[model samples]
Target: MAEGILRPLGSSDLRLSPLGLGCWQFSKGRGLVGKFWPVLEDSVIRDIVRTSWEGGINWFDTAEAYGGGQSEEMLADALSALGEAGRGAHVATKWWPIMRTAGNIGKTIDERLRRLKGWPIDLYQVHQPYSFSSAASEMHAMAKLVQQGRIKHVGVSNFTADKMAEADKALREHGLRLVSNQVKYSLLDRRIERNGIMEAAKELGVAIIAYSPLEQGILSGKFHSNPELVKQISGPRKWSSGFKPEALNRTRPLIDRLNELADKYGASPSQVSLNWLIHAHGETVFAIPGASKPHHAQENVNAMRFTLSQEEIGELAELADRSKR
Candidate 1:
């Protein structure tokens, strides 16, 4: 297991490897969001999962919105292929709340379980805060699932600080707690720090699962070195500000610092960035970097095999701070 220390996903009993595989790329090109990545063969997905498992990752994060449960199915199949299915590989998924009510938490759970091949949802989350009802209502529904043994933990994604507290309070009413909050956090986008999300998670004992910890490969420094590479990639990231010239120019210094640290540790820039993130807030922050290929999965697990000193972490943080100026 590479001596990778397992961290808690909040106060819950769930102990996860510092990094988990984000299954968005395994969506099978089935949904509006799934179109972001090309459909992969079953063998390819299995290989990625296999690499991650051998590298020490113990969990995965997928969503119902990702290919409308296709991601969940693919992930389960991959785990099963490796005999790592069942409770051995902890899996987390989110419920799509847009144009839906909290009632769907229970309403659609059967399909979710069926799609997952009955492997159990270790942590089931509400996908967003913009649902038809309040966060409290969503928590209540999630709590019911927990009580019914449908899910092991409750979490929320893309929620504001106040909204997270609201969900936590609702869970508390049932003698439960909101274990985690998944959000877009990375060296390139540290909005959670300025926006109170990280602080709130800490205060409430909620773990922050950082999705896009690589910032869609921006932190890899490849796109910055060769803008032409952007044309070959699919998805909205090519159109996002991070890939634009101005943003690239602004983030170059941070990327350079990542490379420097990478050389010192014999790691890739993505590894250094992922290392800094999981250690960014002690064990409070865990990251889910996606992988479309086996080597990408290998690089992600290699990220956990090393540690960044407080000085290097501080250096990267300072550079990121300056670049944002």
Candidate 2:
């Protein structure tokens, strides 16, 4: 259960473990997005949370769009059942913007709280940059939530460098600061590095929460080792370009390096991938890998047990960069 030091989530007072439990997979088969995962029984949910909690993970990330609050409710139920709620267990949930405007940020605060069963929303994020309202407007609405003690801090997801600036500026106007930006970051998906998001986050002191850090299990090296395994993968990931035979061939070197390091450290390829993610960018990057089962949760925790050397980190980065080209 040993792990790395806790890092700041941004300008917020919350110090988080290197990884958090991504609760999107706990969607319980409800909403549109929830259909991606199978409905987990309450006992299974409890085991996942308990394993993660006992492994030293202090926080969790879920979304309002995830099963339309089914994830939040179930996560809350799991934590409460395990006696971890309100006991250093921070919960972060997002507001689904999509066609909605900033008004909905306030309108739905109670529903979020209602589903959480009075659990404080440690960090509330605007689900995406495509909201009907501007980033400034969304941040302003989130600031109001902070003032009312509805939420502890504000964040955004899938935002560009410029949009992150707008949200930060809006929060600073109200004497608050944008805490984090959750994005689709992984070894295979390094668009944020080439794009301006990484630079802007560092300059603005915003934390980058890397979601899908394992690249939807591609970095786990299972698909590459056993090509036939792809057929068993449910949901849209099988259709993703990364799961294709050629893409697997393309990323073979990076996965090979990950596997080598996994063997060297006595860990799994997914753990090596997750370790590199949280360490490669210093404290600026944190990851939230999903866990459908207790063993997956334990693997996520083990990822924290070892630190990839700087040389190994650079080696993997170079391999990833080459694979992309």
Candidate 3:
């Protein structure tokens, strides 16, 4: 029964689930890759998407850079399986800033549309500010699409406050506004708070779609130990004793606290971390935690099943602050 929590996305007319399933992991495909840096198969991916919808998640985030469009294709694949309800799912996708040419933008959007197979993307965003030229050109292209109704709204990711303001101002010139900036934010990384991205987003009426919201799984408590877990769960890292061990020790206590809290609430560590994010920023903030399994998807959906108290939120914030230093 973890449904009915809808938050306004800044000034946009749209609303989203507190926790949306990210489609980035679908690039790995199934098998050994699925186990170690896994991606679900089409069949399983379909089930997971549907299960997420059943679990009350109405939003999904994907990018063209993920698996060379495999993520979008898989999202489209999942939509083909959902029938009517799938059509209503809010989708947020990105265009690489480097691919900013009008022709290239058309091609990229077409490619994404082909993969999505006509699901009607609710939000389309620029992946990042790759360069000044690409950034400026892509902003215009996004505006053109908004005018043509190919995309519902415009967004940008990995943008700083200055770039966000620039992009917003640029789009506003065309009678449009960038709706969100997807970035890496979690207990481990709060750079947005210092960099003015959060405050600027508040000022500009743009939401922040926090990717890697779990810190590449570091904040999820799964990477608390063993060099192999990092490699197996995260990705291959060059072997170095000093590096891995240090990261482990620093993160261990946080994970321990997360585990303790998880047990008390009967929630997984990932859920706790995401819940913390929800409590940290309220509704304008959303987390997109990817999964390669139905159960993991289920656990992520369970994130909104409980609420943390103000005192607990404060304690976690203090712990995160200490861990940062």
Question: lDDT of candidate 2?
Answer: 0.91
- In terms of lDDT, model 1 sits at 0.91
Query: Mind sharing the TM-score for model 1?
Result: 0.97
> Per-residue lDDT tens digits of candidate 2, residues 1-325?
2344798998889999989999998898998899999888889999999899889898999999999999999999888876634377889999999899999999999999999986889999999898788999999999999999999999999999999999999999999998999999998889999899999999999999999898888999999999999999888777888888888899999989988999999999999999999999889998999999999999999998989999999999899999977
Q: What is the lDDT of candidate 3?
A: 0.78
lDDT of 1 by residue, 184-302 (tens): 99997899999999999999999999998888899999998899998887777777777888888999999998998899999999999999999878999999999999999999999
Stretches of candidate 3 off by over 4 Å are: 28-36, 99-103, 132-136, 225-234, 237-243
Query: What tens digits encode model 3's per-residue C-alpha lDDT throughout 1-325?
Result: 2355878776678877888888877775543323335555678888888889888898899878777777887887886788875666888888765634544676667777787778787889878677446455677878888888888888888998988888888887898787888888888788998999999998898888888777766766655644566555334423433236676687677788888899999988888999998878766688888877888789888998899888887778788777756
lDDT for position 28 in model 3 = 56
Q: Candidate 1 vs candidate 3: which has greater lDDT? A: 1
Instruction: Please give the TM-score that candidate 3 achieves against the real structure.
Output: 0.89
TM-score of each: 0.97, 0.98, 0.89
| Clash totals, every prediction | 0, 0, 1
Please list the residue runs of candidate 2 whose C-alpha ends up more than 4 Å from where it truly belongs after superposition.
1-4, 84-86
Cα error, residue 150 of model 1, in Å, equals 0.9
